[model samples]
Target chain A: MGLFSRLIAKVKGESGSQISASDWQELERALIESDLGVKGVSEIIELAKKERGEDIESSLTSALSSWLSTNSRQLASNSDRLTTVMVVGVNGTGKTTSTAKLASLLNNDGAKVVLAAADTFRAAATEQLQTWGARLNLEVVAGPQNGDPASVAFNGAAAAKESNASYLIVDTAGRLHTKSDLMDELGKVRRVIEKLTPVDEVLLVVDATTGQNGINQAKIFAESVSVTGLILTKLDGSAKGGIALAIERETKIPIKFIGTGEGAGDFAAFDATTYLQGLFQA
Target chain B: MFESLSNKFAGAFSALRNKGRLKSGDLSDIANEIKLALLDSDVAISVAEAFVKQIEDRSLAVLDDVNKSTNPSQAIFNIVNEELTAILGGSARRIRLAKNPPTVILLTGLQGAGKTSLAGKLAKWLKDQGNTPILIASDLQRPNAVTQLQVVGESVGVPVFAPEPGNGVGDPIRVAKDGIKFAKDKLHNIVIVDTAGRLGIDQELMQQARDIRDAVNPDEVLYVVDAMVGQDAVRTAQAFLDGVGFDAVVLTKLDGDARGGAALSITQITGKPIMFAATGEKVSDFDLFYPDRLASRILGLGDIQTLAETAKSAMDAETTAKFEKKFIEGADFTLDDFLSQLEAMKKMGSMTKLLGMIPGANSGAIKKQLEQFDDNELIKTQSIVQSMTPIERNDPKVLNGSRRARIAKGSGRAVSDVNSLVDRFQAAQKMMRQMRTGKGGMQMPPGMQMPPGMAAPAISKPVQPPKKKSRSGNPAKRALES
Candidate 1:
């Protein structure tokens, strides 16, 4: 059977005059299927069952949405202070692109933005940032390839200050949380950048498609750098980003951005209700 | 990260450990635990449910056997392990380098999933296996992607067929065709085509990847998924399967502390085999994915086999010969040797992953220590060695007060740190000399014996039966935990 038709059938079953014990079980399965995780799905079921009124679907959806949307999804940008945003995440999670997209957004909004390619370890990382910079008509501050990322971060902060840019976004190389030296290096990069300007936002970019592993990455990255907010990337139209709901609930870090597509302009401020709607939809 | 999940699975199975006859009800709790463990590892709920249900059904069938003499729990463990391995490792060793030249391999994945790195690693591996492999830079979407591929290819000593540098958003289809043709003409048997990935899987991105696949008509269209990828692994795999169907899945970044339970869902749901695993960032980190070994790893049986292979792989032939001549025949292990050993071990993987490979080293406290393992110790050691003069590196005695102070300053370390490093180096040298003279009967890990003089890491712990590989066979059935 088609997934859409099955979901519709399940929805119809849920709207019955009286919800049966099987109805709750079905509801539980539906939530789990949506990527809310076992923990999130169970808790949501309990919350919905306890506080649910006559309309079960609405109560559950609202519960899931409310819990996801509690975090204040705003970038730490102030008029007085230069916003130094450091982007970090696991390898292959669209960190550099997200950083550029954020920079593109700020630049379009008439904020002076400087891209700092602090991901000196990855091959052609600086060039990738430069290409993004060229496309957006912004300047990128890059260091030598395979050079000290900390120095590059320092230079980025310095360049932002020199150019009077509103935002200095430092794009770090994707390092696994399991690597302690890499984590320490990230911490060192932050400290180095802070020497020049206070790091306004330590944004942890997570792929929405990530599963239970997201929680572990979030917790570790958060512990290392006081990861202030999250950027959920690669959520173009996938149902699996449900792990984000669980991660959001657990880490308590609000997702500030959603990378919708590959295009430089495809990023948007995450709407919890809209995301939850996407999850519920077939 | 998998420790908790392993603990849950163990907790569930622990109930049936000493039971003489298994009741049908016993399978339920174990099944539930296995299901939870799978789900927690990020396996899709439906897939987890289906897998556990099968395990439950199989356990019941074993219990309802006519011959009540059989060990029901062992049967269940065997079934679970075999099924898990079947899903993971059954379809492995599938990459048959085309008998005809230009056996094209198109790699697809979400952006930043290490396609370029994989391409390099695959080329090196194929070359190591006596095949001429050339990399095709078909990922024209990302800026400087061709350059990046070229860089990776150069590092691996493989040639990369790339389009001329410009706005790299040139026709990837055209590039792919040209690359395949070039490999065919050059008589390179293996062609690895690296494609671009969108931050999100959009229509255009899919179309571009699809177009490249059609153009290449690759022998192997390997879907490279980051094992660290959580919930979205199955959906993404499904989308790729539908949009640009791949032959197999390659799990990358396994060395990363990934609860990549998504691998289970991808294999179980899509029926795709996880063919290869990229354990570390280096080109050498790539290896054949062993489902049996991985299943044992998930079950908290330490990965002794993979660990030994990692150590063995670290010792290239030249290094092995050098060690044999330098350490075994001529002299004791030097600071230079210590530094090189550190480099090799570091290349193997992160401390956490390495610890996971050691049998029973996954203790809670050790796992925690591994989390905070001063991985920088390798870098520090390297820097200290690099700071020293050649004479000082070859002979610890050469490192006098002035030299120690100078080396420490150069490496951005203190004199005390340098002194300690030298002291450790000397002690390690003495120990290696003793081992060379058979003073300590260090039991080398099985399946990893190589050329003489290759430093057999002091494995004081008992050599394990390679996770569950040996026990999964009939002959070693007696060794099953009673």
Candidate 2:
């Protein structure tokens, strides 16, 4: 797992010389395994080439880190008005469960929170949200099955405002990028929510195990709603260490939180040092 | 996306075709091109590197001959295609029907990986193959997870065995054990245990999954993986392999725009075969995973095997025969026939996705037409066509202004709707007549040229080589002096 040493060995251990094809190839391998796409890998390799025997680690880290924000990675916790965090992602990425976890995180912090079961598409999705709410002594606002998700968000906004809650996390339905009509409909859902309060954080929940195909999904969401952040879920500890860098580089969206487990308390803000250390860890 | 790579292969082959002999270094460009395509297709980085290396070695081997007279590119494609097929585990393996009754299949994956849905699909798929399957709702962790599996079970026409929550919470392992017992008592030959999934991998979840594995000692423990999980596919697979080793992997959500990298990486990473792939939401939309077919699809070569299967399932012999007779006889293609074909196509799933498999079907016009086309349009078309009298349906020209008005009134559609149907039917009939008379400019999908000795009919089927052989007839080898 000495991912760091392997990355820097060719530079630190070798005599000062121009980076050779083999060195570039090895770096490319590392980048690709990191879930960085072909486009991003080539771009990083080109950047690392200029350093020669210079501090290649920082040069490359900076290149990868440049896509993420330099500011503190925190949610919209301002006490001005209700700060709504709208969670969205394609199906099977744990969007619904992550919503529950996010609610729990906020609840644990003693922030008044209201959950909006805006995903009316799945048959038992609302009940799933309610069950999570019941565990934490929180209430979930939901609408009828196959109802307009935007209206559900609207109802949720009303509920949050009436309770004078500090935050509202709206869980939207899982949809694919290929369906333009549905993608466009997501935009409508956002505008509907924005009417009540700013959607300070529209986190696109992605599975850590997802490959390069997820980049396309993220790109679409970013383009449509200006996705503010990413939430990496299902990180049950594996080599998916590369995707974090690739997604940040591709989507230019900072990863805000990661779902470490299925429990309501398994989420945390993404720390750059810990993640970078993890990449070189194993 | 693979289409671009397919074109690149054509370019590379043509470049080699012009050269009299294969230079060892000439394959470097093709190797890089193929590598980029593999990465784009979601093949893991290290795995893609290894695969490209294999192709490079194979290509150089084809050039080893001194009297070298061969289509080197064709030889390279065969090698590359063969290696890709082999990496995908060669062939589809059906579910292992245990010698003893009550074959238990434990389903496990991260939350939202479509485990519950796959359980229902597996149960239905088994039933279709003449086996009784019962589902066990052991995913008690997620609220309503049990009820969700129950709903899926009812939809698939399979009975669900859910242990009532004891003390407000029942251990998943206990539920799994009791479910198998219930299956034995009820004589349900197959017991599919749908286990709980955490949003992420956790010690507690894995411990429970492992406990269930030990308790049941199931014949088939299938890890249901989402095809959309690209790079994460291998890592998650490795974790599951180590935590709760499974017999096979079940890929779900392939109907989405899956680059198919995870599907490619899982088998290699875990040394397990992908036994089944569930495409759409329907229980019937699942099939045994065929590596060769998937290879062809990934190569941007249309999946004729899948197309044939989809067609065969959707169309009865009588309907196909009637269509053939009408085409051969140059008979007018009626609205009724068009209605039936439309229904068949809709049954096959997304028109846009299906068209990707057919040569020359990825055109903008066709995609646009499919996007505009919907079930409502089909229903309206059906209503309009069905409203026509026998004389009008058989001979639409006889459908004058009065007949059209009467039919529109009967169908509760506008006069324009009826008029549009007749016009569209006439246009289609003209196209069919031209194709039937051999005057139509019909472009067949490449690799699917009409087989010699098989007369061209309106519906053209690709020359289906034996599925197991996987395009073994080498064009490059044939050109070489063996």
Candidate 3:
């Protein structure tokens, strides 16, 4: 199955034009399988049924479009001062890699970018970011291993301010949302950076393949740090990234960017039309 | 905001109450709800559908038989558990060592699936099992992937074979072949090849994995996957099955709150047993996967077996006998008894782990309460109880305003806190008395009810729980009761 094809196939698999009970059930299964979640799928099915459209595909697209907002899709940057983007997420969701990719994107656009290796918890995490910084030829400020991450973010903010950099990307350690202490540490890091320079965007990097718990991750992280946007990573795989839609619906946080592959050039701005087309593509 | 899968099943079957026989409509309703729960947990659509259909058919046939149990839901639950266990491959499968000296194991998965971390954990596990394992850093595709593996190897006290300094520089296939040779020359019994995390659809990288597998000819190829993975689990598992053909599955990041329906999806689709699970970030968090435990967890029944084991170790025989004697005699379960039980609970593990072992304990207000719970609360309760005289400990009814004030002063807590502790203890004592008079009826906290048939077997099924059954009860009745 490609993206929402499992659900779309339900509509196309029917012999007649009119929708049947089994078809509806199959559509429900498809939506649930796509990670829309049981509740979200139930709401969508109810709405689609009420609309009584000519087909199931367009109704679901419209239902999804109603929940999605394209206004906040642009990466917010402060014009009068340095824009600081703080990236955070659960373990192995590619927060560090997304931070590097975001910095590289801003740097490639003729902007001076400084990367902050603030992930002082995970082993070799600092080295991973430093290697990316060295490859991109961007300045990276880091602290000692197992040191305070907030202090490192503060240092990165100071370095960006002193160097007159256009942007400072702070990459925090990957911490599960269930860990309250780790979440508090993230808040402290954000507050420390805010003391030097306000964080313009707190992007919660979510794996495209994450299940229903992705909503919990988004909600809890937003509660901790007021997450400004989402960065959906690992889209090159078989996952359709449906959780992004569900998360956006629940949190009202727009996805500013997406990671298509492992390469630095595989990122692009989130376009709602293109994304919806991919989702509903037959 | 979705109810746990076990809760969903409970809700669906709640309609079956007072019904004499299981109707087809009731069966389909239960099946439909179960299907939704499975999907919510990220099980593949086709697999969930097939599984629900099979269970529905089996349940109908079983219910129509002559040997019908009184509780229809319990019968259905047993059928579902058996089918889930069967689909989960019955039991945990360990690694098959090579007949020759150097056994090779290949690790493969998608990007950010924790292949590198799993490599370290597997190496540490093998080392702990009295085997010399060498980690091969063949993940030359990602930036500094080799450094990450080397750091992991160093922490685990295992040597890493990274012939090429990996920054998209060297051939992983050649490195894997050379790694095996190096391992054999050094007399290492095991060689683990850690490959780059790649897309299942990426033909080039999938071919790279295949080439490495062919070159190494490892004894086992483990497909590591994130437990939080959703619908894509089927597609990716299928892709790997066709592209690189793994021998067993290893689920990582089980520490996360995700229900891990991907375990069911991958296991059922590939017909491969899940061998191990990486629960936390540490190498020591890795262990053999238990299918029965995961099945109950996925169903939202909690890990009763693990909880029983932990409680059995922490709870001594004397305390069990004491508690039993008081219960049968209908004696008041005093604050002192509550304090001892609290101490035993503290010894069992963290409050979070204990709370997680109870059904329906992972949601709503209980979750909030769990977050607020700490050992200090237990200590304060202990202090408040200790401050009381023996008479007051025996009967909290004597805890009037003056005594509570004295306890507050002695425990260094507010009077209101001491008063609340006494009130809670009195409430607990009353509940225990009611349980005794109710003939050992299943007395669960509000909203934490186990399936009717599941309560009795929980203690005996997990491990011998206390083993202080009343000798006066009828033996045959006890058998039926259990």
TM-score of chain A of each: 0.93, 0.87, 0.93
Residues B1-482 of candidate 2 have per-residue lDDT tens digits of: 34434554555656766776667777787788777777777777668778889988877766665225456566676787788788887888888888999888989887778898788888898998899999998888777888778878888889999875421378888888988888899999999998887433577678889999998889998988888765657767887888898899998887766667777788877879999988875678788999997777555456887788887988888999998987877787776677687677667776555656775433444334444434355456677878887777777767666777899999999876665455445545555666777885674433223221111212222322222134223433311211
- The worst-scoring run of ten residues by lDDT in candidate 2 chain B lies at B452-461
Best of the candidates, lDDT: 3
Q: What TM-score fits each model?
A: 0.84, 0.84, 0.80
Backbone clashes under 3 angstroms, per model = 6, 7, 0
Q: Sort by TM-score, best first.
A: 1, 2, 3
Better of 1 and 2 by lDDT: 1
lDDT of 1 by residue, B1-482 (tens): 45666666666666777777777677787888888778777777788888888887866776767127567666777778777777665645769566676788889887767888888888898899898888888777777788888888898899988875634557888888998888878888888888887533477778878888888888888999888666567777888898898888998888766677878888987888888988776778788887878887777677888888878987787887898888657586776776677778777765556766765556565465555555456677678888988788777675556787899899999876665455445445555666788875664324223211221223211332243233322322422321
- What's the CA RMSD of model 2 in angstroms? 9.6
TM for candidate 3 is 0.80
lDDT of 3 by residue, B1-482 (tens): 12366666666656655466777887898898888778877878889889999998898777766136767777787788888888887987878998897999999998888899899999999999899999999999888889889988999999999989988899999999999999999999999999998888899888888999999998999999998888889889989999999999999987767777888889999999999988775677677888987777655667888777768978899999998998888787777787788788767655565657676565556555656655356566678888899998887666666777898999898876665454345445555666778854656533223211112222223322222233113434422332
Highest DockQ against the true fold, candidate: 3
lDDT of 3 by residue, A132-161 (tens): 999889999999988999999999999999
Clashing pairs in 2: A34-A242, A34-A243, A209-B232, A210-B231, A211-B230, A211-B231, B42-B261
Q: Give residue A273's lDDT in candidate 1 (0 to 100).
A: 74
lDDT string for model 2 (A1-282, tens) is 344457567565443245567776776776666676778778877765554434666666666665565544677787779998989988878898899998898898899989999988765788889888888899799999779999999889988999999989999988877666678888998999888888888999988777776777888888888888888886655645467567776666788888877678888988887777555443
Cα miss at B467, model 3 (Å)?
Answer: 33
